[model samples]
Target: MMTTYLERASHALALVCRVVAGIALVALLAVTIADVSTRYLYRLTEGAIALRVTGSVELVSYLMLCSLLAAMAANVEKSQVVVEAFSHGLAPAIKNRLHGVYLLGFAALGLVLFLGLVDSAQSAAGHGEVTQDLRLPMSPIYYAAAALSLLLGVRSLIEALLGALFGRDAEVSHGE
Candidate 1:
């Protein structure tokens, strides 16, 4: 029952994050288009209109970063690349445990990322750091990334524990 609940709750969270990631990607596309079009328009006008999207590069980088970070937790499980050749012959119960171990590994990775992002954000905050082009504060971006990393770690950990404790809802398939 506990595993079931965890699975459902985590699934919902992943769905929401997936939407956020999608929106970020769309925004990235729009920004790129605007930047390029403005550049082209300026050239077409022979410098008549001094129009350019400033900080576009920085904005792209930030959007890409946020999109990827938002996606990590949502896609971690199904995106794992594992060789299933040996596990093909293993019993169902053993396979489940192996999957649990894999999930735990993901949790550990997320924890590492969370620690690093948080540390960097703190350092940036202390130093009053900002992006080179946009002059936007860096700490908030780092904090948001750190929060997402934390979600990845916690959700992965919960799924790991769920897979280990109960095998009914925990299914693992690699390259299938």
Candidate 2:
């Protein structure tokens, strides 16, 4: 009963994350398109006068990066694309064991990503790098990406571990 509750809660969280991330991605795309159009229109209106355009591209890049980070976390949760081609022939117990091994691997990956996050944060601090136009410390964005990646890794590990320990319903929808 506890497992079921946890699973349901995790699924709910994934759904919310997915919706928010998807909206951000769409908004970023629209913003990028608008920026391009605006710049082109400005060039035409200005007529051979080059205006020193400053931050739109940088802003767009940061927004896109953030969207990508969010999307990745959502993708890991809605992991539907499993390779069961050979697993079909295996016994149930063996399949569960194999899945457990996979979960361990995912946990290891999570550890690696967590370590990378530390390194990235330290490097950013040492360099004092900031965005060209926004002047925001680039370290924070890197840290955000690292944190999201770690979250994704943890989600995968949890799914794999749960499936291995309690088995999984093949019919359960992996929808975020």
Candidate 3:
């Protein structure tokens, strides 16, 4: 019963991350279009409109960061890529064990990234870092990314455990 609840919660969290990623993608597209249009109009009118979107580069960078971070959980859960070239001839049980090891390694990497981001966030906060044009605090973005990294780590670890215990069957059933 507890495992079922945890699985549900994990699924919900992954769904939320996917939704946020979609929203971030839309925002990124809109911002890029607006920035391009503004630049084009400014060039065409010879600065008559005076409508160049300031801080557009910074905004796009933030949007991209957010989009990537938000997508991590779902991407980790989904196993979007499969390299069967080497593992194709391997026994099913061996392949599953190797996959489990791979997931565990991924989890470890995510944990390292999460720790690095936390340190970066703290350093940014201490230094009062801000974007050049918008003066947006950099620490918050770092912290958000850190949170997502932690989530990805946890999800990866969970998937690794399941893969180890139930092999490929677990992954197929859990959509991992």
Query: In TM-score terms, which candidate is top?
Result: 1
Error of 2 at 6 (Å): 2.8
Q: How accurate is candidate 1 locally (lDDT)?
A: 0.80
Candidate 2 structure quality by residue, lDDT tens digits, 69-102? 5675555533344578978788766665566556
Q: How far does residue 68 in candidate 3 sit from its true spot (Å)? A: 1.5
Better of 1 and 3 by lDDT: 1
- Pairs in clash, predicted candidate 3: none
| lDDT (Cα, tens digit) per residue for candidate 1, span 1-176 | 67657877777778777987999899999999999999999999999987888999999898898898789877766654557787778777776666777889889988999999999999999999999988888999999888888888887887777666665334432121
Cα RMSD to the true fold for all candidates: 2.8, 3.5, 2.4
Residue-level lDDT for 125 in candidate 3: 100
**What would the C-alpha RMSD of candidate 1 be, to one decimal place?**
2.8
Worst 10 residues of 2 by lDDT: 167-176
C-alpha lDDT of residue 143 in model 2: 83
Sort by TM-score, best first: what order? 1, 3, 2
TM-score against truth, every candidate = 0.89, 0.74, 0.85
